[model samples]
Target chain A: MHISSTEVDYIALGASSDFRADGRHAFEFRDVIVESHLVPSVSGSSRAQVGGTDVLVYVKAELGPAQGKNGTEGVITFTAHYSSVTGLDNEVRTSNMLNAELEESLNRLFSEKQAANLERLCLLEGRVAWTLLVDVTVLKADGNVLDVASFAVRNALLSTLVPHVEVIRGEEGEADEIEVDDEPASRRLLLEGDPPVFISVCLLGSKWMLDASQDEEASMTSKLSVGVNSSGKVCGIVKAGEGALEWDGLGDTLKTAANMGVKIIEGLRKVQASRAETVGFFA
Target chain B: MGLREFDYGPLVSVERGTEVTTRERKRQWNELRPLFMRTRMVSHAAGSSYLEAENSKVICSVNGPLANTGGRTEAIERAKISCYISRTKFCGLEDDELEKRATTEYEGIVCRALESIVRVEQYPKSTIEVHVLVIEDDGSTLSAAITCACLALADAKIELRELMACCSVVNANGQLLLDPTLDEEKEASGSVLVSYLATSGKVSTVFQTGQLAYDEMAQAVELTISGAREIAVLVRNCLRQRESKDRGL
Candidate 1:
């Protein structure tokens, strides 16, 4: 999508005046609707819609041999795929770039933040463990896809049920037998507090705005994607766009993003708890 | 392929924290490793530089103001900046595929950082290519790549706002280690890389990973900026030295 010079100037002017095209304040976020446990086949699944952007996440757990020398912990990997109808005007190159960016961001968020305790997935030390494969699909792309994807991923992981594994000790040179219970009721993925969520803040002219729309993104100066958890801590940060940010504005942007991220996480948790029925894709 | 045919093993193994204690004893928490950098190392390229921060060694070369070959004819405004970063086989202890992926990710990061410093508007409808190769890697390769690329761009005589100086800080346990080594980086809970322009007191890029408190993040940024300032002085001195040599001083 291409915007004219007049459009960019108009967006900037409105942002500077604390007004947005969608009748939202500079710091206001679009209404986000989250639905979890929609896919029965997958271990966990969720869908998040932020305004026009829609994202689906599925978490699948597979039993595999433990990785690394200290193989007492499980592993989680993230991969993102862009559906053909998503965005970039169906350009393959840009879609591939976006896919790589989202995957890298998600992997870094989970691995570096240590949001979920992987020790809980370990069955036998240096032998067997659970490998969580998180696949994220962008059904629609308006804007703020990374933030929405993070939300869906966190919810999907939260709803994931790991089966209980019993390790029977061997007697006198016998191999230890591993047995996994296939019951539907299982333990939840142990998390360290609330998992971190990414909040992308765009610098529009002199003012910084949260949750920018696609039009706003096209006209924005720069963007900062900050990963913030419920405890008001930063997990990761990535800067995009060609524009430069002033030194004085960096601290303010980070602080505002952290505060907003915490609020969003709390709000989403409330929504998740209150959700009783599956809000399917069409509904 | 059979079920579970491929097992992508982890890069590093959990080790007893004993060796790290000894390593920490040798280097102060906030101390930086020795820095050795030189420009004009590659005669064939427009500009080139090699940077060695203790065990991490990086060579960067800058070429072009070449024609914009991206095929996007929609009225070019500023020159496009492109960066490619790769590591040699013997660079470090990482898998080949993983290293390639890492380099691809860093390509965007290094490109953006340079774009902020380079006066791209001066060369419209053109492209500037920066190629960085890691000859060796012990730790802090990303910071080394950025710093080296800046020197190469300057050597190429590209117009710029100010040279970018970058530094990395790793938060190990509760302590902040400046310019951490590979082992230290592996054991770190979080790390922050800041690319700064000391002249304008503005930061071009800030990439952070791992979990950190708000206060810790702020402190790390401040610390990284100061470290970058130190590197900026060294970079300036090196450039001055080159100028003196060219003038036969």
Candidate 2:
């Protein structure tokens, strides 16, 4: 939505006083509601709802030839699908830019950050490995879509289970034969350490706010998306928008984002630990 | 099997006795690769620059501020920028799809970084297009592309908020390596690239991948900024040389 200049002025005025349209203070985020393992057919699946934004992530594992120099390690690829209903039209270049930025951030989370140890997924070194395809679809986007998408991807990856594979040496000059154990009990999660979650901080007037709604996002001067894992380490950072940030403000923004990310990861862990059942979308 | 032939070959040798692959840096951690820059390399384009950072070579050309003939007038307040990045067949290891994907990603980053520094509002109802081609990509290709594009824009005499220089730092384990080579980058645990406007004390872009502690990430950012400052001086010198050459000095 194209917010008028008056609306932008109003939001800026409100932000200067630590007020927001949703009655949340600056540095506050809307509650994140997540449901994991919602799809039984896929290796793992999750749906996360943050404020009005809704995103779904599905992880599927397939056996494939190893890639590049990391022959002993498996590969995890991330692809984002923006549903047409999400109001992201191709004509508006800003939305397209947002989509590209979000996809790159997710790719960096798994491929560059080493969020998960992929060696466990390798069945036969330099020959066969489990290639995980993580697909994220944005069902609705009210703003802060990157954070919500990353949250769903991390949850989905945590629930992913890969089946055991036994490699049998073939006859001379022949390819190796493999057997996949399909027993439910034989499947197990291979990754160690939690994948990072993305936290976006937007400069609204003079205050840096978290989880800006679509309207608030339009009024922000610039935005920074910081990816931090549960262990209080920074995974990745991508800055967006047209506004340039001061040198001193960059440090403060990163510090605030790191603190907020750790707190949110802890909260998410507690929420997952206390969960009883899947209680998917219908519930 | 066909794609394997395009491989650039391993940078390290695996000893027959042990499996350790060791690579030693040729320069100090704070040292930047020797820079060679030239402007107006393409006579046809509005502005052009060819920059070589040691082995990484990039050529950029800027063509536009052309009148917006098509498309509905959406962003009339500021000029739009479209950036495209491509690599030559002999630039590096070849994977057609991967190269395409990398180019698109770099294009987005370069565009966004320049958008923040360029004075777009002055050229309303027009567009600025930047095209960058990588002749060689030893490492830090993204940083080189950014610098080359910035210089091209300046050579074109486009109005900008300030001249921006970019620097890249790679963290291998706990040690920070500035201006790492391809081998070093492959071994790095994390990497951070910062594009800074020294005069204004503003950061136009901060892109990072891999994982590091917050303090480490901060340190890397500071390192890149200082490194960028040094490069900014070099950029100024190159521009000055171009000016003198134009005056038949």
TM-scores of all candidate predictions against the true structure: 0.89, 0.89
Worst 10 residues of 1 chain A by lDDT: A184-193
Model 2 RMSD, rounded to 1 decimal: 7.0
Cα lDDT tens digits, model 2, A33-89, are 988878889998889999999999999999998754658888888778688778654
Supply the TM-score of chain A against the true chain A for every candidate structure. 0.91, 0.89
lDDT per residue (tens digit) for residues A1-283 in model 1:
6778899999999999998988998888899899987998988899999999999999999998876448877888888988877765655425346677888888889754367667766788888888889999999888888999999998888777667777999898987879888764544543434679999999888888999998988898778899999988899888877666665557877888999999989987886666533354643
Chain B TM-score, one value per candidate, order as shown: 0.88, 0.87
Question: Model 1: how large is the Cα RMSD against the reference?
Answer: 8.1
Cα displacement (Å) at residue B69, model 2: 3.5
Candidate 2 ranges with C-alpha deviation above 4 Å:
A67-70, A93-97, A164-178, A190-192, A274-283, B1-26, B96-101
- Model 2 lDDT, residue A265, Cα: 79
